[model samples]
Target: MTEQKLPAATRGPSDHTLRDQIVNAAMEYFSHYGFEKTTVSDLARSVGFSKAYIYKFFSSKQEIGEVICASCLTQITQRLNAALEEAPSATEKMQCLFQTLTVAGSELFFRERRLFDIAAAASRDRWSSAERYEAWLRETTVAILREGREAGEFERKTPLDETAAAVYLVLRPYADPVQLQAALDTAKEDASRLAALVLRSLAP
Candidate 1:
């Protein structure tokens, strides 16, 4: 008498292409309106479907929200991974990353802005995945520092783990309600400088 939990795609559209469209439309609705404010009706219209049609694809708002959050996380990680692979030096990789976060003349587009908005609003009881994401970013920066140390790019004796954490800590305020005012007041503020402080911690 146990109920079966269906997979995301198989629960509705088995075709991967159609499932992507459903999620993309939902992403737009969620971003244009806050998660709680977005209705299934609005989401359905975005996809040229009826409210009933959406229910065929997703069980509830939470279900779609979870999928949206996961999709965004996967996307940014993929982008960062690709950038990391192309970078011969960690400094350049880290620089490329920070550049993406705040610089307009980069691949990180306005589309990414919505993802960040939703990520900040998701209802995850455990922050492990989010923390892990931040940790991975820190570790990537640390790896870059290690490479620099060997190549005579850095000369200091600071602890690597601490420096890595600091890199994220500087950005943490942007997500926090209190310090986020700085970001809201001016998007042009230098996240790169903060990241540079972390990078320089390894220098002599």
Candidate 2:
């Protein structure tokens, strides 16, 4: 393992940066306290802003949740691409993805995890962006697999779309709040196994 630098948000104009501050505070409040238990006021207090000020930034708690998660999702995808650059082989690339996944919860994105938990489910209660995010993940994995195949690092026999879809389904649980929290140690260990399985199945 190496000393990994956490991804830092690039500073933009002050006007646009304030929204990220509000989202950051909401992520903290929601992740530390369950979503249902957290109130808009709690999010406001977390950011040292008044409840009225919170409304100026967000229309509702749900809006805050969406903004917070959307940012985390965008950031995670960016970092995953960065991780790929540091890995020489396809297997190593996939393995580094787990590190990226774990960091999503470790950063200012914890409340974003709670949002992910609800978003991962496909049931009626699933958040609106859940399906869209899942689709994005599937497409990303598919792209990686195709790239590996082109590089002659992954087997030509494996169906890229199918395997990518399976990868998302398999990894979805660990991306959740309860499963990720309860199984952190187990997941850390199993991440190696997961990496091995992906390599064995996909290796050229």
Candidate 3:
């Protein structure tokens, strides 16, 4: 028989509201103490629950971290999708994509320094949610590239996959927390220049 997988909320809480409270408390704990230093007991106390009670929803602290990671990526995906929808042209959409990444990533990174470390480690370890986010990012980028080709906004002879990969790499610094923090004061300027260069690469 195939095993049944429960929904995130159902796995932990009797209803959605309590699950949200747990998640919010976990986010606060992890942000302040960093995930490695936070204990199940600590989070449980923060939520006024017993360790056993918290376990009803989250199997472990790592699971809580994963949930936070998934939530962050979901927000980024929504913002990207909204930008894509609002942009009148593929070129503008591509521009909006990087800009959105810059703004969103910077805000998160600035809020908690260790958040970047968690995401980087998850990415290196090929965590499922992180990998899923990357796949979505790549597919979305490829869609924009293909749209640009169809609209005569881009004349690149490279395959769409290669083009998307190249574009993602070139703009990595704008969205990478480590790099962004290094030049935090100049981030906007750097991203604007990088965006211009990326657009030029796609020019016919």
Best by TM-score: 3
Please identify which of the two predictions, 1 or 3, would achieve the higher TM-score against the true structure.
3
**Runs of candidate 1 exceeding 4 Å displacement:** 1-25, 39-60, 104-116, 123-129, 171-189
Error of 3 at 30 (Å): 1.7
Q: Per-residue lDDT for 22-72 in model 3, tens only?
A: 888977887788767888999899989898877777777777778778877
lDDT of 1 by residue, 1-204 (tens): 122344665656454556568778877876677666888888788878787666766777666666766665556667767777887776777676665544421223243565554565542333444555556666766777677777877764767677557666765553332244346546435666766775666556
Indicate which candidate wins on lDDT: 3
TM-scores for all candidates: the values are 0.63, 0.66, 0.81
Clash count of each predicted structure: 3, 0, 1
Instruction: For each candidate in the order shown, give its overall lDDT on alpha carbons.
Output: 0.61, 0.65, 0.77
Clashing pairs in 1: 90-144, 156-203, 156-204
lDDT agreement of model 3 with the native: 0.77
Q: What is the C-alpha RMSD of each candidate to the true structure, in Å?
A: 5.4, 9.1, 4.3
Backbone clashes in model 2, listed as residue pairs: none
Name the candidate, 1 or 3, with the larger lDDT value.
3
Which has the better TM-score: candidate 1, or candidate 2?
A: 2
Error of 2 at 9 (Å): 33
